[model samples]
Target: MTDTATTSSSGRRILFRVGWIVLLLLSALFAVNHIAGIWFIAASTDEQQLFEAFGVVNLLAIVLLVIPYRRREWWAWLTVWLTILPIALVVVFVPDAIGITYVVTAGVMSLGQLATLPSFRPTRTAN
Candidate 1:
């Protein structure tokens, strides 16, 4: 096995590790949303329907993202595209409800992308 080095430093490796951690954490939050949906559906609280529906959608996203998703998987990218499009719409139309959920989800996506960056780092040809 070879130790891959990019950008002439070890910081990229460290960041990559941190990025995975963040992705796992985000996955957990989506799991929570799934559970919360169960609770909301069982209760009679205000906006219970909305809570349940949102939970189901989030659970679908969690399931989609949880599977072994390589860059080669078209469905994986489709899942990501489905997730982001709604967030973008919400941010553009419902600006006031930019909640912690948005922050956490976006942060997770950002870190996950960053983690994969080093693996695809462009190679330079020596003259």
Candidate 2:
């Protein structure tokens, strides 16, 4: 590759790493939010079942974040989208302070994935 192409490729790799970092941060934030939400809900309702359900969902979301971290592939994007879409929908329909927080944070997470999509292009190997 020419110098320009090499530079571009390096730049893309850097961007991809940054995107993954952002996604990781978002995952952490979501986990914290869900944990707190579960705690508050459990306290208010005395509902262990609800707590367990939300806890399981939160754990699953955090686990799924690892997929994109380990493999920058299209499916990773889909996974992240699947994780965020329900939160986004709740934000849209609920119209509460917490919902607004979800929308803003999830929106940033979505944008991070969008920015990273170009970097996920399959690298061409030499024949």
Candidate 3:
């Protein structure tokens, strides 16, 4: 590749990396918030457990995104869509602050995935 082409490719990769980092940070923030919510917001044992579980899921998302997803592994992408996306979508209909936040985060995450679609595509080699 020409110098210009190389520079552009690297720049694009950096952009994608930054996007993922932002998503991971957001997920971590939400996770911590949810876990702490048990102390301040949960009024019952079940609700406390529910909040903790959400925190766990958010942590899992951070792990997946940082490791496998960053490497463009197909399974990680599928896992996020299959697990996280559905949960966020369901929470979106709750008509509450947390619900709205969850949906917005999910939407941003989805857009990130779509924006990095080319990075995940299989490359072709010359014969």
Candidate 4:
């Protein structure tokens, strides 16, 4: 409705919205993919454990990213940083996990969102 949310093709607002949507979708896909490894007793214990482990961490990262917190805070910063380790694990160990790429892409989006921090300037100057 306002200039910041305008949807014109050339508008920064539109581009930002598109970027966010892409990131959210990627995160969702990653969460669901990891959840796919269901553990029924006596049925592929190793695979199930692996999936649960990956899924829990991926889900936690996605959840943290969605919280309404400023990027500069410790928890918000931690969310971005903490996401890197498991992603690296997946990339190195499980090449078949298509969702790792998606999670990584979403992590990029989180970084981009954090980049917006500089735009929030206070009207008063500091001493």
Best by TM-score: 3
lDDT winner between candidates 3 and 4 = 3
Query: What RMSD value applies to candidate 4?
Result: 6.0
lDDT of predicted model 3: 0.75
lDDT of each: 0.54, 0.70, 0.75, 0.56
Expressed as tens digits, the lDDT of each residue in 44-93 for candidate 3 is 99989888888888889888888998888988877766535744775645
Off by over 4 Å in 4: 1-20, 39-43, 70-74, 95-127
Model 2 residue 88 lDDT score: 73
lDDT of 1 by residue, 79-109 (tens): 6556544434544544565554575466566
- How does candidate 4 fare on TM-score? 0.54
- Model 4, residue 1: displacement in angstroms? 19
* Candidate 2 lDDT by residue in tens digits, 29-99: 66665577665655655454544554565566667667644576677677778766766776766699977
lDDT score, residue 122, model 2?
Answer: 73
Model 2: lowest-lDDT 10 consecutive positions? 46-55
lDDT of 1: 0.54
Models, CA RMSD each: 4.9, 3.0, 2.4, 6.0
- Global fold similarity of model 1 (TM-score): 0.51
TM-score: which is higher, 1 or 4? Answer: 4
**Worst window of 10 by summed lDDT in candidate 1:** 1-10
Of the candidates shown, which would achieve the greatest lDDT relative to the real structure? 3
